[model samples]
Target chain A: MLKKMENNTGNFYIDVASIQKEKHANEICGDVFLTKKVSAEDRTIIVLSDGLGSGIKANILASVTASMAVNFTSMNAPLAHTAEIILSTLPVDRERKVGYSSFTIIDIEAGGTIHFVEYGNPEILYFRENETLELKKTPVTIKNRFRLKQPLFYSNCTGRRNDRIVVCSDGISQSGIGSRAYPFGWGIKNVNAYIRDEISRHPGISSFDLCRKLLANAIANDTFKAKDDITAGVVYLREARRLMVCSGPPYDENKDTMLARDLDRFAGTKIICGGTTANIIAREMHREICTNLSHTSFQLPPVSSMDNIDLITEGILTLGKAHRLLEEGFKPDLVSKDPAVMLCNHFLLHDEIVFVVGTKVNEAHQDPSLPVELEIRRNVIKKIARELEDNYLKTININYI
Target chain B: MTEITICSGTLCYIMGGADIFEIETKLSEMYNDKIRIKASTCLGFCEGENKQNPPCVMVGNELIPDATIEKIINHLKRLYTR
Candidate 1:
């Protein structure tokens, strides 16, 4: 069997997560964040940029800065040269240190080493276990006509389990402004204290959940209205946790015993999709299937549960909705308390995903007018697999039976 | 017009169910003009490792497991006659 996990060469797994606070309900987030996973070296490169002011102007500047940083890193250009070129082109403020658009470059490897580079934006917080890991800040000026005093920070730390590196824009620190509770704003001290408290309260918090918790608090501190456009990136290193999802049914009934045994022997979570597939597995394994007839998704049918199966749902429609959700974007609160949403969240949480697809087509789904054929259904699975790799940075393997 | 799709997936093709491919030339004279015969990577019906029903075919949305050429032709006749 081909290994579905990326832990073959590396001792650590990287969970890269980010969240952004938009200026308004309908406007694009001014703080642009980009993440690219280098397949050759298994390295994760992240760039966060906060443009001058907010709205479209800031969005454009931040987008340009973030993309340029990503492009430069992919080309293996010198960090200093890339920084110099980015600063020279942008209109820097005389009062601030190479100010116009601020950036933080984080290059993390699967082997537990952190290559952190920061300029203009707020300091990157390094955390190990629960407490903060402080690095000495040394000011290295970027040579320019205005004598730019950008802080050139370079630090390397070998990551262990539960090691986290957080980078954020000024918007996070500037939260709670104009509020009675915090006359100035939620400073770096408060943010650090909150993070430390959360870490201590709950161990093994995921990078995505941690980033989201901070963003949510920041927004709430401004009395349900964010004081500024905020952005946060939380990168974590740990061992990989693999998950197996068995969907559809095999082509022949004679193969049911092997399929049942495969599910029973799977070390990770086993999910059975489709009613007929679940029934076969249930019958073969002699396990009771408790189905929840509650309509979970508006478009898709409700979910079912078996004694051993982690999750069970109607096959194609649920997968379709899950694919759409991932494609549209990763928003935790999009469709709260739904089966498809729950499945998508589970998919995001796991590092590796194994899809066991059954090559059986359902007659109920076929209609002359509907165009729900075997080919269309198989295409849907392929589309879902592609979205998982592209959007979530997960290692996925598809086994067709 | 009727559409006849044969499952050519790993399980179906292996079960000798994909024999529809061999008889397409013979059926072309009798029903080729009235029906569309196509081979699909997976006709979506043989999911269980239980190859009890090795070959599968789809006429419209109806699945015919343990499908043979005669079974498929009869299914097509029934589908179109209705």
Candidate 2:
């Protein structure tokens, strides 16, 4: 998951994700994709660069080009100057005598304005509501002191909600170069058609999934062996997916009503983590919780169901286990009927997570006979929040009741 | 429908209620729609007179202490036959 640009002016949330596949038999990919969020300006810059060949030399070239493109773009350097610096900095190949690397730069501002610059790479594909958008591009020519004149394309447009911008290396556009399936290569036209079909089928497809699908198709076009380094970067503008998790019970019995009221007013998915916490909400809202014994996991207590709540589980233990799973880099395969796994899945699926933790201590957990791993509720919640923010790039907010 | 509520509180679970939960699948296969199984965070009975006999389970209106799969199944069979 990509870290979202905070304080976005437009209501739409920007999701940026990418995938890369190295050429067959190569230890490292020759294509490099870099994304940097300029928090001060509330802007994001993405750069994709593909070098001349495969292996170490190409990898270094692509990395240098991509890093320079990201830094120059973020610094607001003139388009021509940025191109000149990148072109002059690229080292010439001893055999070909040509310093070559294809690059695509995308700069998106807070108010939905986007500026794109492309050189040697395929033109970015823009989609709005499952339809291809035609962006007018101006050709730019840079003549530098090295007497090397390079042609670059510049385009700018405003982004709308549900709009998607996809940029790729030539490897994606030329996946099946010599294959009988695509005599001249996969081509941009076919790639655009595939994306259109994908959008029509799943209107709410995320940038990460879209990029993965695109890369998979590109590799298949090469008969499951990529001929060159392939990379796809997707920028999606859409409404954010939010989730609210209420754990533990408030310290003061008087504040129980307040917790329930806040939960009732939440606009997104809701979860209750503690038995006492769920009881408080059920009592205040006059609702019932029906536990599902069939989904019980040996390691954790069975999950329960409540009105208007997405999931209900045992607190401390589940949260502590979830924190450990995230720390070890949780994956889909690790998922089971375990409440901790379910909680981790919910945290991973949403873009924004709000944790409403109650400060009250559960007297039962303080018993000496109980396992020592039963950490304090507040401490466990804090650990989970930190893992989500630092590792998973999720937007997290904690409210102590 | 025979409603079976199993206590899944920390104390009950630790005392063998965890294994009793799997009876849902067994009861469903044997009796199907006749059994309605659910779990409760705490039946509030574990802290009282029957605290020593935990993993508690309630079948219909009858409360059974020290619940096991066979014991719960026997109770279910009796209820279904009635």
Candidate 3:
């Protein structure tokens, strides 16, 4: 599950993302990854569980363990109690003679405190400022009636901005098992080295992209065929990437300068959606709108460029099409040439999206003969903002001028 | 290089500038690198008396009102011949 949650810690945003690959020939991944944000509590919980074997049975075991881990942790249950519940719930394997599933639970509070618990899973790696930190873990043994004894490791730490917590299943650490290069396995040491090098090379890599790179490397270690279900989750605390979208013209013509001034003052990616809106900014800033003809799409109008503006496009039509694409859960990278897709991509990629919507109604669109789909500018922006917030978990702000 | 500016404003786009953007393929084959084409947001020409003419294009210093692909092509041809 790829979900990002914003922390109200004021200085940093908490981005949590995960990527998983099913074992070779398995219909479903035996590893289950889950994330949830409790808004009232201002807490985020991430769970990753790897089952005993590959295929559907293993998937069910992992799913049950992961879901229970997330719920228990969110409810502030004791670690031993959570482990007991999970162990009792899983069905025992006939051959192994044990109900088997390995899980890692990460509970992050609003004040930067992280509670990490692991049972039969690889240790989570904590990195800050290009160096990995050695986390102190306390081992606890849970003696329950159903099972003899289960060992769990608990670690509590406070994270700062630019810190990352990476958790993965045994499948990742055990990748390339029995292979000549890594006869033992691609152990945690190699994974740590790879992550360190990646952060050094790309200092600002997002948590989602880092997980993708790690997963790709792990898949390659197994000679392009994973021996078991692999899962990698990264929780990154960093400054938020913001994008401001200015659409339509301001309600009052005199306030056009105010729009331009706001856009100029914004210290983030800037996108102008409407022609008149772009013109207002261009004229006020004394910049030229250079239309990009190379990447023209028949479905949507071609995108344009201007000084200090990241993207410029035709307003209502492009926005409407972009809204539809976002609603469809379109991936912008696949067909990025379209103006609508480009807009949607910006909205998804950024941590926060701010829309500066102008309220002036264009007389041209008022014609009843025009397509009824030409909704009012504010309504379209509102729809897009809603989709972004609800589906993608993005922080959205719409200011109607 | 000859410059052609197409108005991508709302009125111009609805009037016919949408098809004018397609003239790039034809112009690239005809003029090669001799012409540069760009689009601007509302050239501010479609107001007052100029409101009667839309889908405006600027070919060099001359503004072609109610522009089309063919008209822009003809204007480009004339400019190249000169």
Candidate 4:
């Protein structure tokens, strides 16, 4: 768990919490900050991504999405346009079909303007003094028809001051406070009322605390374990804010040079790499890279920050799909129109970023030197990028190295 | 000339490996003047899970799984030599 106080023009704080359940062999759902950067005004902008399907591949989709979104949103571009650019930029995997991720964006301006947009999940609830609740649900949603489920755009209502927004995945909802499957097709009012009546009570309670209560409520209601990874993000708005960008170990050996190059161009350059990359990069750059003996995974850098892109990814998809439905002309009080949201919200994190690193084939029992299916995968990536208007970085930025 | 079929459906693409299309390209390059290759939407087998076994191949009435370029080439070689 990590906490930071922002000294920006606005008074704002954020409390985030995520929990994953072993839903089976293949499903895992979590949240991720695609990328994080402090805006010129010193406020923090966060984007969450939820990849389609579950388990490791789903984690990678959400991870890459959060990383890219965080990296670009810092530029303070229009969220809609920035989202479009990101959609266009992702590399599509032929096996997983990686063109889309459920996205939710929270922008805390210096003056404390909380702009919230969700694409998949429903609007998070704000519970405060006397159980006064605020639910900023999107006006539209993507509903899954029997067949022909396509990505749809939706619009979001503006944010209210000091409104605590609780964004989450269906896993959180399905788990529900009572542990009975979330009353399918239940509206935000029902969700909000349940939280207010059962969970949120007390002033200045951190959002993360509220998240825990919500998850605990769900678990306590039923005797069975959750079948999916559960994720929840809470954003508290006041007036002040600060931002942190968590970097992780490189997927490839050349990451040392890449880090040096990226750090040279960006200000407040803090190089945080993990494990072998951490040791080598820190030694070469003369910077400190945090170490953890508990986790041997190569993705220790960003995960070390506790932002845990895996969790954020689930939040993004649930929220992004919710937002898309609103944009496409659905009402928050109505049913969602997108089926991808349901399928995408079902997974957990991967041990490493897939396909991007290692030889053409690694330990997956394939030939290492051969490019396997590069052309097909590349085409899928290109088609998605073109359709979504995302800036897919086809070539690794050698300048970073 | 050799005829090649590439299935782009969900299951075939998934079980067949996304890189299966390279087989056609490799064959084309190796026997550039000898074969004609193209892509098709679905081979009717990928729709149901039953037809989705590994290395699924159809030559006349023969269904081959774990079908590789070598196997494909040898089959073609036999037909051509005959």
| Candidate 2 reference-contact recovery | 0.41
List DockQ for all candidates. Answer: 0.02, 0.40, 0.46, 0.01
Question: Of models 3 and 4, which has the larger DockQ?
Answer: 3
Q: Write candidate 3's Cα lDDT for A150-251 as tens digits.
A: 678998888788888899987789999999989999999999999999999998898889999989988998999998899999988888789999998898
Could you tell me how far off, in angstroms, the CA of residue A279 lies in candidate 3 after the best superposition?
1.2
Model 3, DockQ value? 0.46
Docking class for model 1 is incorrect
Off by over 4 Å in 4: A1-12, A16-22, A26-30, A33-40, A91-98, A127-162, A176-189, A198-200, A220-223, A238-401, B1-82
Between prediction 2 and prediction 3, the one with superior TM-score is 3
List the RMSD of every prediction in angstroms.
11.7, 3.6, 2.6, 21.9
Superpose all Cα atoms of candidate 1 onto the true structure and report the RMSD in Å to 1 decimal.
11.7
The residue pairs found clashing in candidate 3 are none
What is candidate 1's lDDT per residue for A1-401, written digit by digit as tens? 01121333455677777898886453878888998877777667899998887777678778888988888877778878888777777765444554467888877665646677787788888888788998765555675445656667766666666677888887788788778977788888888888888888877887888999999988888777776789988877766767887877788878888888998898877776666677778889898766443342254445667787788766666677788888998665645657678788778767788888888776444535332333345677788889888766778899888
- Every model's TM-score on chain B: 0.75, 0.86, 0.89, 0.62
lDDT of 3 at A136: 92
Task: Sort candidate 3 into its docking category.
Answer: acceptable
lDDT of 4 at A98: 49
Worst 10 residues of 1 chain A by lDDT: A1-10
Worst ten-residue run, lDDT, model 2 chain A? A1-10
**By descending lDDT, how would the candidates be arranged?**
2, 3, 1, 4
Tell me the TM-score of each prediction against the true structure.
0.73, 0.87, 0.92, 0.40
